[model samples]
Target: MIKSVIGLFLPVILALPLAAQEDSDVLFTVSGEPVTVGEFRYIYSKTNGQDADFSRASVMEYLDLYERFKLKVARAREMGLDTVVALQNELEGYRQQLADNYLLDKEVTDKLVSELYRRKQEDVDFSHILVSLPSLIPADTLAAYERAMDIRDGLTAGNFADRAAEVSDDAYSKNDGGHIGYVNAPLPGGMYRLEEAIYEAADGEVVGPVRTPAGYHLVLKHGSRPAYGEVEIAHILLRKSPEADPDMQKQRAEEARAALRNGESFEDVAAEYSEDDKTSRQGGYIGFFGINRYNKTFEEAAFGLSEDGEISEVIESPVGFHILKRISHRGIQPEAEQAPLLEAAVRQDTRFAEARKALFDRLEREYGTRKVDANYTSFVNGLDSTFFQLSTDLSAADRDATILEIGDQQYTTGDFVDYLEANARLRSSLERRFEVEGAAESLFDNWTDQQVERYAEAQLEEQFPEFKALMREYREGILLFEATKLEVWDRAGEDTTGLEAFFDAHRDQYRFPPRARVLKYTVNTAEGTDAQAVAQAAEKNTSAELIEEFGTDGLRIEEQVYEEATLPKGVTFKADTRSSVDQVDRNSAVFYRVVEMLPARQKELSEARGYVIADYQDQLERQWVEALRKKFAVKRNERVLAKLIES
Candidate 1:
């Protein structure tokens, strides 16, 4: 197990660089390797927080500790621990973990999230004419795109609805002049592009030929309004009937409202007059509802109630009269409060994928990446029917052929094969349905995307200075942990002779305070046993002897040692004396008999092994650090140090 020495070293590895410094900014050197002022300042500021006042004493104290840390890291490098395969792999793993967050275009993601938040404040009323593609094959897609363009070229404010009704594939809205009602931001997954197009267009503006996963869409904006976020309402309903006049229902609703005005609780009025059996039991609660979930009349009346517990005037929808009481209303919150939700929504939506694709495309172009068409085709053609079963023998295949070139790195055919092997189940499934050529193409595209992403991740250290600094900190932390384990911790524990010697020297420091060895006895009075007899026997006999004599039937005895402070309250310590038996309850009695009272004494090495080993490790670390200081030459720039103190 790797015990962390990063915390022990304190301020050295705590913080990443705030900004890069020049060669002249070197604060000190350990074995000729410069430690920069910027690096020192960042770690010192972060570690001390408000106490980092740059006073001479504080700065010098931290600087001394940081210098020791650097010397240890230098020794680790000299030992060639950095070149060890396991440590190299661990460092790379950490780099990859950090890269995931740095790989995305934060500017683009933030803009998308902000736009979604702004659009969430209002609902857009729009209609779309979908030119449905029969399949996503190139021919079908091109035909759909062309047909959508032709329809868009002829579209205007007057004929859009008519054209949509004639040719649009959406059966739900085609017959209704293509109006799908008012929609808002975060329009379900796979429709983000459509949502963006509609929200971005002006009223009566014809937009799109915008392609979504569904098909191409020609959208017409029909204006927007402040969003009806959601409403929690309880309603009292009066259903219309064939036998009763509609006016009678309205009259009854008016009477119910009058009863509410006359100080009858809404729940009581609803239970008495509400016809909705499902909700009358719940005081006619419909819970919270957003726009378009309920009918226009019910939604408008419910949302129209401005204050909590305010009742609406009687509203009549297709079912009958509804009197709504608003429980609560939730509108759009401010951007800072809403950004997290909007960001989550954006990520779940397809737009996040689109943004990542844009990033990958930019990276590929910047790096001048190219696909080796001949090499890829050759590899794909070499696959046999066994490839579908993931049993193809690729050992004899030309593994060295370069399939892709990104910057100066060439990804070989063997690399692609390895990726395929890793995704064996997915590849086999794809091949079973689409066959080798099709599966090969799909997997190759995915592999290419991963390669591009990896390349971009590799560039992060060069592109972002803070990323480099962070990697350095983690690498050093790992090195320090391993170095300390080998130099201090393992030695302290394994060096039994050295541990005993150290313990002998510090024997007086490790001592047990005055303590009493006592035996507690309990007898269950319900068992009709003599409690006084049990206590008397416990004072002279071991627990095993008492258990044998009493046959272990509710006669219990336990021995323990307690120090003066830890002894039970109201109990006095006395050697060779038994306390008076006290009845614990109707069923039990308890008493303590002290066997022996011992004075303060030194602890054995075995008794204090843990504490002794810890102290020994600290001693070993200090000696090792002193040895390292001698082995490595440390030179400090006093001018920079004095300047830091003044600042």
Candidate 2:
């Protein structure tokens, strides 16, 4: 059943019409808003749309929408919404917003190229035996030596996996024959010590008895990877629970099939039966995700299926009963989608390729030799001091033994450092962090990701043609929401008369959760300082003076407390203080005290006035954004929209 959809879709790929000029004459109007030919063509070029010459049918759909839009805008004018203070404020807000995008584009894009051009190729593939306890194998001895030797022999003899299956200690990799396959060139800088050991090995050679805080490792180099991108996939799933009996499940499935055959809803059946509560609530929607997002079994089954809405039969996975439905599949998932894996690969390749090519080109242009000069020795040796901490001090005298060559040109120490420093700068600029006390740099990036903002911007420009002049509509819409919120929603600003009336009308949502008042303190060590000195010191010093001198952030003295679950991480009940989102750190804390507990009580207007105002503003804005939709008569170009719909 699934095979047929793919068989059909593959042909559709071929039959994708050679988009013609007809698509251009097609006019799309949204409430008297004319979507120009240039705009349509440009949009189609960037997206998956029918780019044929515009036709009457194509243009008519847009015209209908344009009519409705005109009607709404006309109504808005009648209501004097254009002159509205809220509208003017909203337009001004987006003016700042649009201006910010240009600066952001330049900042992010300029940094991408210089950052890509750096480095060379040196990779490793190693395997290991990890013992979880450190002290057990600290001293190098015959026993530790013999154990590593034995593991080595087993690996060489094709039985290393069997031995690892029986006795290896690292919970992460022991079961898989000590296999942690090819990472790029060097292992990434931190986190996994075992990964580093593997990267430092030579091909077909055994290295290690390398000590980590966890245990000793004997990594053997096996292989490496050259260059390749990755792929992505998505699927819908049908799952069964452990409580389900095989016979009973099959029977229920048969009943479901009969219902489906009798014209019953697949959604209803899914809602009633799917064990996956998250997707089941949305009628079994899993949306788009990448490979490796699920277990090997689930990944295989879903990608192996084809076409949206095509469901599979009872397939066993670690997560139990599954009836997977294929939704969409993509190639080499977006860098951000499979970020940890894909971006790492791309970054390494970009650095190595750019660095190697530029160096090679420079050498050919200048020296023109197939054999490298002795100067490369100093260049290669210099890297030891520059890039890594070394056990042995390197000297100019030792340069004679080191032979470093790129094609015919020999690299000198100066050349090596030049490239090294250049690469280091690029890395710094791209990865530089401001070290926000609590907020993550990437979290802020994600917040600024313009997901909803871009959509709103595009639609606003489309809806209002003189949008530059009329943007006040959108800005005011947003600002009115903001201003109304500020007036009533200020944390410390609540009008008793207004709140009392609000409370009298809607008392249900105001009922408060059990809460408390917390005096919070957060102390942290600087980066790479893994020691817990502050946590340790807190036990000895509780004085506000000494504690203030200690590295802790002090939140409000009388901050409202929340339920234990309501408190974010780094916060907990203490005899004296509480934590908040502000208390973040790699280092743990000691004096986490809850100074006072406030019982859940009826919420007065004063207590919830801020929230009520915010809610009112949100409702008003939603109403306006919705009303804007009505003002513009809308028409969907389904023929042009096939791509998004199918995906």
Which candidate number maximizes lDDT?
A: 1
Candidate 1 lDDT (Cα, 0 to 1): 0.86
Q: In model 1, what are the clashing residue pairs, if there are any?
A: none
What is the per-residue lDDT of model 2 for residues 196-300, given as tens digits with 9 covering 90 to 100? 455445576666666555555766667664322222322223345567676676566555555556765667766776666677767677766543456767666
Worst 10-residue lDDT window, candidate 1: 15-24
TM-score of 1: 0.73
Output the lDDT of residue 499, model 2: 44
Off by over 4 Å in 1: 1-24, 41-64, 93-184, 199-206, 220-348, 377-399, 414-439, 495-501, 504-508, 514-551, 563-602, 635-647
lDDT of each: 0.86, 0.48
- TM-score list, all predictions: 0.73, 0.29
